[model samples]
Target: MLKRFPFFLMLLVGLAVASCKDDEDKPPVTPAPDTVSFVATISGSQQVPLNASTATGAFTGTYDRTSKTLTYNVTFSGLTPTSGHIHLGGPGRTGGFKVPFNSLTSPITGSQVLDQQTADSLLAGRTYVNLHTTAFSGGEIRGNIQQGTTAPVPPVEFAALLTGGQQVPANGSRAGGALVAAYYPATRLLTYNVTFSGLTPTSGHIHLGGPGRTGGFKVPFNSLTSPITGSQVLDQQTADSLLAGRTYVNLHTAAFPGGEIRGNIRERRLGITLGASINSAQQVQPNASAATGTFTGTYDRTTSLLTYSVTYTGLTPMAGHIHLGGPGRTGGFKVPFNSLTSPITGSQVLDQQTADSLLTDRTYVNLHTTTFPGGEIRGDIKVK
Candidate 1:
């Protein structure tokens, strides 16, 4: 009986050892996912007003629920893009533009912090990305910013060039000013800076009104000094009004009690970089001049303004102009530069028709010289 008891004890010990071994061999459990992934296969056929373009693209993104930040990358082939934007819409629908990407080059990558409203719409699969090309100024490739996983839960920039002419009763103050501002949607905070010259600012306020009109004050600066820099938390109504372009910065002076210099607080739209490589080869009738040059500029859609600089080598430019034409073609002059010297820099406010032509890859830069007579060098202006 004693020997049988010993055997039983040993058997129980062996079983316990085997159980411990089994537990050690088990796999570890996986933690829950913290980020959501999204993807889109962009195609021309997906455009609201579909077209026959054969270009295709891919968009991949990740959204962090806790941080409310979206990181994305976009790649495409078969077309040169002019601009890209994220719009609020669903499949087969058209809506207003929400976020404009800072760059048009592929593969485009960027990170943006979203506000509660935008984040909700994104998670609900109610947003889409549209890429615009010269061939299709509206949109060439379209993709719905859809997500496979679900979770949770933003910056608008604006600027203004202050001038006396913008004042309600246009002043002759020979003074100028500028205002640059950015609004964070997440916290409803607006940070701004106002700089002025030739005026002693006694007071300043952001008033509610359109161009050439005036209304009640919505926001008052904490300081009346020049180069006023401050931040304020805005309510929903005030933020909406500001974003809708119904606000202006008014600086009051002793000489002008009403206002001295005023500027419309316009939302700075996404700007497109335009460039051209000017050589004798791009002329309608190609020449053999050894001169080469480069044209670079930024086009602001909101202001219809093109600020540009031209640089050249090996030739003396007599005159230069932006002509309306496609690549390898010729057309009439649309915009002439103020100076013909090398490294020419200037800004021009384009009419609607001329702006449209420029956006559609139908414009060229022609630099004429006495030697070449007609045109010493030419290059097609295009989105870079």
Candidate 2:
């Protein structure tokens, strides 16, 4: 027994030595990433009181939670920025400056140590970055800071500089106006704001034609008042026409019945497309039906707003909802559609939690019918 005990002791020591050697041979543990990346899309349309400058920019940064340090870089074109800074503000609301860049140059780079309050605001997306140019001293290009490595897709922007020279046969009227708008491709919706001066506008319409041609009226302003603001859901053909730069905004007046001032609509950037395919198979309990549908929409990250259109073929839907769940999973409802007809179109403001789930591809559209009380058709939303 004593001799066996000695041999067992030696075996135990040998095992311990081998285990230690194995530990040494294994790769070193990689430290978990402590930095969170953030990004923003800068444009003139994002300014508090929207500007007419065509400048665009991008802001990228990384926040180190451990060190409380923020490192950032800014790149822009089309404007000679005189200064820039980070400001404490929310979308459409202005606030005081929080941090300043060391230099006012394109491809601006710097680092700052943020206090607890500023850090919290930044992570909550309550901060914005902007650049001031001679033309727009208040800030020519601006964007709200949002968390994520990839910049959120910006809404497609369009603008028109109305002038008498662009009018068909040209006009001698000393008047001018401007149009700034955004188009969401998924919902086929266009929201515009127009401002004019030196004319009492009698009527205004978005005409379908090129720069020097006169065509039929497409969309009309809800009001002839200055600062006209409204939205319109366009058909596929009209949307295509606008994207082709074949549309113009024409404001008619008592003096010039045709058009006092006009400008061709020009696209600043293409829009983001989000869509889903609906079928019975995606339901928690798959149904045996020929019903199928599609959901197409766009999410404006800056406003946390979602606009969508749903169309189905085989099922008579009684209701529809946005369910919080991933593919093949059942979850609670997050949003309800305003209408249940064959084609459902609506917009809703999403809370942070719901928006996060949507951006992560963890939400779906479920259409309920009388035959299937739960859901007749389901589709997982995806960004394209």
Candidate 3:
């Protein structure tokens, strides 16, 4: 029995050795690539930190090569950040930009793609991230972005600017004071800059009405005077009226209870002659190719209709639509392409908010092709 046991043990050992030899002869198992993570901490001392204040902040980034998307998860303390960026450079080093933020409002998160050069710089541990605010146009808080493991923070892009102006009193008080208004489409915050030389206005309100017409007040100001600035968070209804071109700012005084000065609100326009440079660099999906296009558009706020004519070169058109986004950020679909002929003519019945986006340069026109599964040529539809 002992002799038999020894023989069995030796047989088992031989079998194990044969199995190991087979494994060596066969191809080795390959591991899948991991999702790369990066982090940054910004302070006044960091080279190239905007240093808007003695403030500080942090950033987290993840890169997914399958989708070729880079997403940022960010947080900041002791600072108010309006925008952010991923710039190329080593610690205490100054370099160019790699990726720009899609949005930087509170609860900051943004996603974007980078060109090959920028992507290489980032993966090689040669980049930094930063946050920007009104006070700090360059940047506020910044941190060196390095590859390391940290808890995951998911992010998406915030981003818009809409502007219009009203001259006091279409027919009433020729009183001085012009109201320049800017609407942030992303936050729905409306700001007004008022300047006047003559007139003692008791109060002022943005009312819903037309030139020579009167309606209920929509947004009321805290006070009125020369070189005054105020901001209001807009409601849906008020935004609706404003986009319809039926709203105006009126300065009310004891001298003119109805309104001393009034000016109508209107939308701006960007001519169709927009020469758009189309290339893979601008595509949501990264590639390397070039295309050309143009966008001509006219919008009427009262009717809420946007008419457009688009032209393209270097590809056959498969499909097209209007997208709500800017240069570096990809946004949701808003409208579709209609005209099939040269100088394709299409019209969109937009909502008040959509109208505001068109006027504020928040909307874009895009054309897709079979060759290029993604967009071939796109132009930001702006009010120039």
Candidate 4:
């Protein structure tokens, strides 16, 4: 009886121990729903034609994973937001998805309820928050709610311009040297000067244009102006266009109207043209050995004008004009003289001032032939 009693007690103890171990191995039930908090920067090229500081704000929003609900509190610093919404969809898709917040005013704040799937999508980076304004009815500020990562700061490329060099002779000067154009790509600010042969000068201006095309007014050249010097104070939009190969430079004179000496300026590269050498304005010469090309469209910046006339001719054009350059040799970007789209013929009216920087000598318009895919005939513009 005593042995049996001891065995029974030991069995009970072992069973109790085994039961507790089993319970410990099992996972606990899902925890009650809790709110997830996150802060994100919301910015976008909200306006169709985006500009600096267009999209603004740090938007704060919260998601209740348990209730599948979300709320957003947003405010802008510079511009007041006229409209706001919580946009759904990833990178490329239609804007319509969900709207939780509506009628967002300054110090924009709002809330919305989301379903389980939508909440999951938002966490997965399939959705985003966006705000709208009068300037950007589409959307100005946007942020993708997801696992955040830090971004590395970009390095700045800066340089200084040197002044005072040996003077060059009249009617003749040395060539082949580095010309520095200090440009801030983000702002479109430019400081440039050319250094070459010794020569004397009265004053100068930087022409914006290319073959047979002269750009708008001059960006005054100052002391820092090198061999040939000038400053083309430009806005961010204008500067972006200029960097897009739409502007150039030419030190002007009463003698050289179109541009005395011209060089097409683009990002990092410059094409120089002597004022005396080139064909007549508006004359397009085609090459025999090359595939045909033509002047198709014309656009003016200062005036905001645009004209499209499809004209095509075999060979390529030698000379053309959107004249904006003065005299001397400095050209920057170029406008589209001939393109795959509309070609040009006789006379064509142009836009008032649409992307006018493109019309400046800063761009390129060369005759392309089968033999010369690069270019066959070329000419820079001078104001006649």
Number of the predicted model whose TM-score against the real structure is largest: 2
lDDT, residue 283, candidate 3: 69
Cα lDDT computed for each candidate against the true fold: 0.79, 0.84, 0.63, 0.46
Model 1 Cα lDDT, one tens digit per residue, 213-288 = 8998878988877668666778887788888877889888899989998878866555878999999999888888
- On residues 74-175, what C-alpha lDDT tens digit does candidate 3 reach at each position? 777777777777888755456777677766665578788777877778788778886767876666556767777653221111111212222333233445
Provide the TM-score for each candidate, comma-separated: 0.38, 0.45, 0.32, 0.34
What does candidate 2's lDDT look like per residue over 254-299, in tens digits?
Answer: 9999999887887643233679999998888997989999999888
- Candidate 1 runs further than 4 Å off: 1-154, 272-384
Q: Candidate 3: lDDT of 93?
A: 56
Q: Clash number for every model?
A: 2, 0, 7, 80
The whole-model C-alpha lDDT of candidate 4 against the native structure comes to 0.46
Pick the winner on lDDT between candidates 1 and 2.
2
Q: Per-residue error at 46 for model 2, in Å?
A: 3.5
Report the Cα lDDT for residue 223, model 4: 51
In what order do the candidates fall by lDDT, top score first? 2, 1, 3, 4
